[model samples]
Every structure is written in structure tokens, then in C-alpha cells.
Target chain A: MTDTTARIPKLTRKGQATRDRILQAAVELIAERGVVGTSTEDVRKAARVSGSQIYHYFDSKQALIRAVITRQADAEPVPGRPMMGALDCFDALRAWADAAIQRQEENGCRGECSLGSLAGELGAADEDSRQDLSNGFLRWQGLLEQSLRAMRDRGDLRPDADLGELSLALLTALQGGTLLTQTMRDIRPLRAALNAALSYIHSFAADQR
Target chain B: MTDTTARIPKLTRKGQATRDRILQAAVELIAERGVVGTSTEDVRKAARVSGSQIYHYFDSKQALIRAVITRQADAEPVPGRPMMGALDCFDALRAWADAAIQRQEENGCRGECSLGSLAGELGAADEDSRQDLSNGFLRWQGLLEQSLRAMRDRGDLRPDADLGELSLALLTALQGGTLLTQTMRDIRPLRAALNAALSYIHSFAADQR
Candidate 1:
């Protein structure tokens, strides 16, 4: 949070709106065509702003992309997934998986700009973007850990269950499932992936005897 | 197979060598950068071939990328993964997972060009590329399915187990796990993902009664 806050330049309300417009345009463009495909000039035109205006908010393309990563991270786009927060129970986790699969199906399995996709594109070559993506995933993992810890406290999960590994597995299923869904143009991979992860979690369920 | 065969232009042995050089260069560049970042000129320079030579082999950048995808598919780069084949039993599956994690660890978790990464970059926007990627994953899935079927035939797994879903689940864990490993710069995610999928499969183990 401090890092993100410190990077933002002071701006009046109007300036903030202009910056948002530029950022939104960049996000859409980057989603459609990755970071390498999106140009500042393209963002400028998409935002309906002048070249100087884009420069006013972001000093360079790297800065703009970093800003996008920061925004995506802060937004908690993938794992938390907007309305699907507080995954503290097995039922909640199952619902989350269903929602993700349904959403992908609704979109015809077209891959969108999620943190995972961004990481897939940027994680290899760019060190800074990799760090940003790492942080984003860590934050998501923290949320899942909190939920698993809650389940453990509630005696829904076994006391000895490995919460960290469980959370990481769920996340891995998600990132991988979504990738396959995009590539295969089908929802079954995502469904199978999530079902396997969920069943794995269920394997660790408390005996309740 | 017929589609790929029809697309290849007839070439002399030297012409084939030149084409191979160009394709290899493009693969390296695309792996390091991405499909968008690697331009025709870059391929020309990297391959040490003239622009006319590149055009003689690949009529367009799209054609070159498609060729790469087809090559990657036929090679079965992700699931078969070069040396690891016939993942028909529990031991082979565990060994494959360990090797994957070790390989990622050796590379410092730098994401390499795999079918997954290429699909992540090109799957959404390009229909032709998306079809190519879809075929690649389907081929890998077929290999996994065959392995799982062998296990079933061997009475290692329950006859009731859904081999297709099981195979898809394993593939999802792999693709998702690899993506997370690349982003987080850690092998733990991959380890957990593979472990969970393996556990899921183990859950369906024969009663041995």
C-alpha cells in the first residue's frame, strides 16, 4: 500500500479523472493485446487524451504497465475475484469454483486480463513486473490462508492440515485451470481442476466423530 | 496432421535448414520475449538470414507463430515434456512432478516458452492461433488419458474412475502449477499443485480387497 501510494503523483480531481481514463484505456488494450502489443500512442488515442496528457500521468510505458499491475493487484482480481471474497468454508470454495467456471463459459472461454494472465505474459522477462505479480499472488494466498485458518479454528478442517499448501494448491488449480480453459475453449478443464483441488481439500476434512 | 502438412511449403534440404534456423531463432526470441515482442526483423537478424529468406519460408509473422505452435504441439512439450513419457502409474507421476519442480528451481523460476505461455499470449485474440493451441492441449490430454486408461486396465485405479476428467485434472494442475511457479519464483506452488492432483488420483485408488 505504501509503495503504491508513494508512486501516485498529486493530482486535482480533474487530473485524477484524466489519469483514470488513461489507465482504463491502457488496461483494456493490454488485456486484448499484451503489454508488448500496447503502445503509449495507442493508449493516448484510446483515452482520447493528448500525448502530453498521457505523459502527465505516466512517464513511460513501463510506468504505465507497472501502474496497471498495481491496480490489478490492489483490485484482487483473480483469487478474490470481486464478489467472491471471504472464502472461509468448503462450501464457499466450491461456490467460488462454480462461479469462475460459469463466468468463463459465459465469456465463451476468451481469456481476459487477470493477474494470472499478466503474470504469464510478464513474469518471464521483466524482473519488476515479476515482482509485482509475485506480490499480487502472495496477497491472494494470504486471503486463502486466512480462510483455511478460519476453517481449522471452526473444526471444519483437521487440526494438522497444511493450510499454506492447501491454499497454494487451490491457487495453482485456478491459474492452471484458467489457462487451459482459455487454450482449449472449454470449461471442463477449469471444472476438473477446481473439482480436484476441492476434493483434495475435502480429503483433509475433519472426521467429526 | 493433414493441416500442418498442407501448410508447409516444399523446400530443398538447404531450404529446410534455413527454415529450421529461422524457426529456432523465433522460438528463442518468443520464449524470452513474447509473440508480440518478436518481430520478423528480429527473427531475420537472430537467424542470420535475409528478410527475403524469411519470407520465402514463412509468408507472414502469423504463419511463423502458427508453425511454432504446431511444432510445440507435435513435440508434446508440456505434458510429455521431452524426457518424461508414459506417466501411467503413481511413481512416474510423482517423478514427473519432482523433475518439473527441479527444472524450475534450476532456471531460477524464470518462465520458459511452453504451450501454456504461448496460449496465454495468443489464445484470446487470434482465432487461428487459438485453434492451434487448442489442438496442442488436446494432444497432450490424449497422452495423459491413455496413461490413465492403462492404469485402469492394470487394476491400479478403480474401473469407475473418469479417466478423461482425471487426465484433464492432472493437466490443469500442471499448467496452473507451472504458471504460479513462474510468477511466484518458488517451486512450492508447483509442488503443492501436483501433490494435490496426485492425492486426488490416489483417492480413487483400488480398494485392493
Candidate 2:
């Protein structure tokens, strides 16, 4: 976050609004039409910014895209969200799953995961985007791992369980679930995937029974 | 398969070879460049087909893309492969998981799922491509469900096991694993994802133990 803020020059309120406007426009259009399908002219017209205003703020489309990525990555975690904050507990795990699933449900299963959608589309061919997505996913997984580690430390999870692996598995399931949900236009796939993953994690919960 | 075969005209051996050549070229270029990135002229040049020849085979880039999707879908399952043929058994599941992981490994984690890759970029905006992807994923899931149902018939799995949901979960995990593997350029993500999912399925096995 600091890195992003530091990179951008100091701007007046109007300049900042213009930049925000451009990014917001990019987000909506790029999400729908994809990066290739959207052009600078479309962004400029949508944002009501002159061509020079765009160039002054963003040297190129790629720069603007990176900014959009940064914006999305930064906004992933909902502020003041208890569920995401307490994934270490089994109940919180369910809540986290609920939050994840409800996110898609709210969007009507559209663009299940914005960063994931971008990574799937462009990660295969573009090194920069791949790196961005890899970092983005790792950061997400890291949050899960941190909570799992907390669970382990608190004697809620098995000591021998591999937290890193478990976190990655959970993430994998979520991504798969969200993708299926969006494609099939059905919520069941995501629900099943998350449920299975949470069940697996609970399997390591010190065998409470 | 019958649907695809019926679309092409009855052709001589030479014509079949030409069609195969075009599809092969399209696969390579389109997988790497994506639909919007690769052009008809690029495919025409890559396939070494003249302008007239390109038009003779496909009406437009979209038609060629659909053909490519069909070709990839047809080749997804290994002919007479036990692992894919019998996803219900433990050994076969391992083999299938290995195959899925190894595919991405072989490509250095590039475009782990080509159909998925294309769908992510175009599916939300393009109805035809979305339908193609949805069908492709369903067919893949159907193969798993068929094997699971067979396993249940043989008492390999509990009758109460929701085979439909389980198959969906497995496919979801596989897709997630492959996507993470591709993005992170790592194998552990895929390994962990598939293992977790399979373990969940095994938990539903009739407890012979």
C-alpha cells in the first residue's frame, strides 16, 4: 500500500478525483470487456478525461492496469469484517466461507474473483500480470495461513497439520468453486467446494470426537 | 464428439489433414495469445493456409475458436486411461491428480487449463464462448460423476455420498489447483488441493476399516 502511494505524485483534490475516475472506469470496463477488449479511448471517454490527462496520470494502459490491480488487491479484505478476521476458529472458518460465497452470490456469480479472473486470462501469457497475480494470491493465502497457525498455537488444530498446505488447499478450493459458480451460473459448485475444504480442515481439528 | 464430427463435411484424407493442421496451429497461437490477441491473419500465416483456404474452413475467428475448443475438449480425456476412466478408486484418483499436476508442470505452469484460460477472459462478455466453457466444464465433471456412481454401485463408496456434489467439488479443486499452480509457478498448490479434495471424498467411503 505504501509502495503504491509513494509511486504516485502529489495531486490536488481535483487531480486525485480525475485519477480515481479513470481507475473506476477502467475497473468496470476491463472487468467486462477484459484488458484487450478495452482501449484507451474508451477509458478516456468514459472517465471524461482528455487524452493528455490520461497520459499525464498514466504513461500507458499497462500502468493504468497495474494501478487497477493494486486497487483491487488493496481492497480485498473488507474493513471491520469479523469473519475474515477470525478464520482460526472453526465457526469463523464457516463465516469466512460464507463471506466468500456470499460475495459471489451478491454479484450474481459474476466475475467470481476479480484478481483471479484477470490472472486466469492474462497470467498465462504475461509475465508482469502473472507476478502481480501470484503475489496477490500469496497474500491472500498468507492471511489464511496466519489464521491456521493461530488455530494451531491455541490447540484448536492438530500440531502436526501443515498450516501452509492447508491454507493453500483452502484457497485452491475457493478459486475452483468461484470459477465453477461463475461459469455454470450456479451457486452449488462454490458451496460444495468450500464445504469440502472446510470439512477437510476440520478433519485436522484434533479429532474432537 | 458426434456433434463435432458431423459439422465438418465428408472430406478426403487430404482435406482431413488440412483441417487438422489448421486446428493445431490455432491451438498453439490462441492458447498463447488468447482470442483477442490472435488474429485470423496470424492464424492463417501460422497455418500456412492461403486467404481463401482460411475462409474455406472457418467463417471467422469465432468459428475457428469454437473448433479449437472442441478439439481441446475431445483430447482432454486420455483414451483407455484407467485413472480418468475410474476416478472413484484411490489409485486412479492419484493418477488423475498426478496427470493434472504434471500437465501444468510440463508446461512450466503455463496455461494450466486452456479452455479455462479462454473462458475467464471471454466468458462473461461472450455468450457463445461462455456456453462452450460451461459445457466443457460440465462434461469434465460428468466424467468424474460417472466413475463415482460406478464406484457406489460396486460398494466402493457409501450410497449416501452425494456423487454429484463430490464430482463438482473434485473438478472445482482441480481447476483451482491448476489455476494456482499456473499463477504461482509452483506444484505444491496443485498437490495440496487435489490431496485435500480426495481425502474429503475418502472420508465418505463406506468405512471398511
Candidate 3:
């Protein structure tokens, strides 16, 4: 999102792996303590990498954060979680919601959606980060829209359904519900928000035979 | 919420006014920056108060932050913002949603819900702050539920409607929508989320004669 490709240095496979390991550590730290609370030193220690190693991979903390945002935008890059991308049918959408709630429950509702949390902290704090985050959100919305549009094309939803609004509504519910879930330490808010959004989507479902 | 009354020192009317002034300044700083970014020194300079004067009212920076959270919970205490209370009817709920969107538009979607932004930053970071924020959210949700329950008793909503879930849905929409609005710098996500939630609520409205 930040034209980081031009600045990215070519790396050997080992170097790439090391870079990913550092990025993963940074993501975890950022998840535990927000962007402001996390530092490159912390990431280095967590990654068990040397200072030079981190510097070799990332030019600055802001650049590293941008890379993290790009990683988050790529997909649900978190290793164990189910991919939240597919939404070709109603059941897939429902499964996506259930998986989100289950993941929160599994974590004891301690953390939030990584990208959403970063957006919350960095959205207004930095200009470059804001653009990166805006792109992340749009990419996410685009995924949902893609799926919803496919559903409409397949005659699963009404021809008149507005894919953009519906996708944005779903994304907002997830973002809002996840934020509340983090605070309340309860999964119900997330559950209710997603349920409401799903029902709204269903309201546009083509009448069944 | 913290049993702070016993520890609170008695203040003269003047002292109370001064404390409010400091708090107002702190809120502005926190809204602009964040909890992690705003420091006591910043608040002191912003409020034009001496260090001792700030300490006289708030024991520490964390104490001051807790006070800010308290103020946010006291019914949308931000100056000049429309009171987001009195949701005893559908139109009032719609007005609340519109006011939230209008405020975001006015501010160019820079800041999030004050309580929500605090929750975003503090929810997982500090246990005490998490408790304080959980109470803030519950209090806000309670107000919404109070109004929805009133509507139910008056037969405006169906007797079978789950007021708690409905109210939670509405709050989730606001929190989610507001967070997205802050990131996307657009009002449609907030508007769409609230509209969808309101439509869900209206689906439960009592049948017309």
C-alpha cells in the first residue's frame, strides 16, 4: 500500500524467513500491547534476533509497521485461524462469523482483530499508517463484496441487493463487535453484531423454492 | 465504579471547577492522541495548571485517565455534542445514529468514540482500565436497554423481542461503525451499520392496526 515494494531489498530464502519471523513477533507484541506500546527492541527480543538482523529487514519502525499492515491485508495471515476470505454462500458467511466468535472465546476475548486493533490505534495517529490501514480495510471489504456479488450472480440473493453497502455493513459489524468483545471480555456482543448483520444479508436472500 | 469515593479528597467548589477544567483538557488530548500518547505533562500544559494543582486533584496519570473514563461514561459528557440518551422511541434511536455520523463528518472522521477508543487501547493492556472500560460499556448498554425496555412495555416493540440482545446489537453497530468511520474517513460505513441495526430493530416493531 505504501509502495514498499520498491524499497524492499532482495533477500535469500533464509533472510526472508528471518524477516517473517520478526514480523510475526512484532504482530504478536502489537496485539498484546498496541502500536504505541510496542517497539522494535521488543520485537527483536521476542524474535530472538539481533539488533542488526532487525535493522537489516526493516528500515524503521514505521516501515516495519507498514509491512505488518500489508501482511494483515494479504489475508488472515495468522497461522491457526480459519481464513475469513471465502463468503460464497450464506453458510460460509455464517461459518466465518462462528469461527470469529470461537477464536475470541479461545483467546478468552483478550485480543481483538489484529488489523482492526492497529487501525484503532494508528488510524489517526500517522498519515502513512492511515493510508495502509485504509487500504487494508478496503481490501477486506473487497473480499466480502466479491463473495456477495458471486452469491447474487448465482441467484442466491436478490438481484436488487446492494453488494457494496451489504459488504461494508458486514465489515463494520465485525469491527465494532470485535472491539466491544475485547472490552467486555464477552463474546455475545460480537455474536449479536454478526448475527444482526447476517440476518440483514439474509433479508436480501432470494425467496426459496 | 472503582469505589473511588472514599479515596477522593474533598474539594472546594473552586477546586471542583479546576478539576473539571483539567479533565476537559485531558479529554481533548486523549481524543487527539491516545491514552498511551497523552501524558500528565501534556495535560498540565494544556490546562494551564501547575503540576501540584493537577496532582492535587488526580493522584497520578492513571488516576487521571480513570477520571477521563468516568467522565465519558457520564452520558456523553463531551461538550456541545448532542446528548445520546433518551432512546425511548425509534425516531430517537435514528437521531442518535445520525448525530454520531454527523459528529464524525464534522470532525472529518479523525477520532473514534471516546470510550471506544479508550477501550481499543486499554482493554487488553491494563486490567484496571479494562474493568473501568467494561463498566463504561455496560453503563452505556444499560441506558440503551432501559430505553428499549421502556418501548417494549409501551407495546412499541414486540413483547417477545430480546431487549438485551437488541440493545447490544445497537451498541455494537455504533462501536463498530464509529471505529470504521475513523479508519475509512468516510461516514457511509457508520451510516450503513446503524441503518442495518435500526432496520433489524424495526423488524421487531409491533404490528400496526
In the range A1-209, model 2's lDDT, one tens digit per residue, is 32355677788889888989998999899867777778888999999999999998888888887777777666653333554435778888888788877877887887622777777677766778788778878887888898898899899999999988899989888888877788777888899899999989999998568
Compare the candidates by DockQ and give the number of the best one.
2
Candidate 3 clash pair list: A176-B176
| Chain B only: TM-score of model 3 | 0.92
Candidate 1 residue-wise lDDT at A8: 69
Q: What 10-residue stretch in candidate 3 chain B is worst by lDDT?
A: B77-86
| Model 2: residue A94 alpha-carbon error in angstroms | 0.9
Better of 1 and 3 by TM-score: 3
Model 2 sits at a Cα RMSD from the real structure of 2.2
* RMSD to truth, every model: 2.7, 2.2, 2.4
Interface root-mean-square deviation, each candidate = 1.5, 1.3, 1.2
lDDT of 1: 0.82
Residue ranges of candidate 2 with Cα displaced over 4 Å:
A1-3, A77-80, A83-85, B1-3, B77-80
A29-141 per-residue lDDT for model 3 (tens digits): 98888777789999999999999999988879998999998888775623243345567899988888888888888989877438788877776568788788888888888
Which candidate model has the greater DockQ, 1 or 2? 2
Relative to the true structure, candidate 3 reaches a TM of 0.93
- lDDT for position B21 in model 2: 88
